[model samples]
Target: MNATIILVGTELLSGMTIDTNSIYMAEELNKYGIEIKYKFTVGDNIKDIVEVIEFGKDKSDLVILSGGLG
Candidate 1:
């Protein structure tokens, strides 16, 4: 399986907080034989999130998002 991970939140883009979720997820997915094609860091913008998801749609069989809600 191929996957893409989208990190949401302006803090990620601004470097306010360090993200470790992707690292863990990558390791877990790797063990399952899932190839991670792209890791996208997006600010707290709906348009940008959708755009990133759209881009990943063609490249990945699975798309995942992490970080900051509300």
Candidate 2:
């Protein structure tokens, strides 16, 4: 199955922080025979997040979003 990873945080896009979660998730998912086909980083903007989520959902069997759930 294909997966899409979206890291959502303004700090991430601003280069204030490096994203390690996606890398870890990708590696772990690969062990389960899941392929991550696309990765994206979006800021705190709702529109951009929504757009990426829609795209991820449409293109991948599973979509994983990390960071800023609250």
Candidate 3:
């Protein structure tokens, strides 16, 4: 299966926080024969987050969201 990972956090965008979630998830997903098609780091904006989700769903079989710690 194909998957997409979306990371939502201003801290991640700003580079203050290290993004380790995607790396870990990617490793785990690969074991199940899942491929991550797209990975995105979005800031704390509703409009942008929505846009990413909308676009991601069309191209990927699964969309996994992580790191939206507000």
Candidate 4:
């Protein structure tokens, strides 16, 4: 299956924090024969999150969102 990974966090966009989560998830998904079609890093904005998810759904069979949840 094709997948899109969306990492949400201001620190990620600012480059203050490394996006280790995406790399880890990608590796794990790869084991399952899942192809990562797209990867996006956006700040903590609901609008941006919604937009990316909407876009990802059209391009991928699965959408994986991580981080930015408190």
TM-score of each: 0.93, 0.94, 0.94, 0.93
Q: How large an RMSD does model 4 have?
A: 1.7
Clashing pairs in 3: none
lDDT of 1 at 68: 71
Q: lDDT for every model?
A: 0.91, 0.93, 0.92, 0.93
lDDT of 1 by residue, 25-65 (tens): 99999999999999999998999999999999988999999
- Residue 52, model 4: lDDT of 99
lDDT of 3 by residue, 4-38 (tens): 99999999988788999999999999999999999
Model 1, poorest ten-residue lDDT window? 61-70
- Roughly what TM-score does model 1 have, to 2 decimal places? 0.93
TM-score of 2: 0.94
* TM-score for candidate 4: 0.93
Give residue 64's lDDT in candidate 2 (0 to 100): 94
The lDDT ranking, best first, is 2, 4, 3, 1
Higher-scoring candidate on lDDT, 1 or 2:
2
Worst 10 residues of 2 by lDDT: 61-70
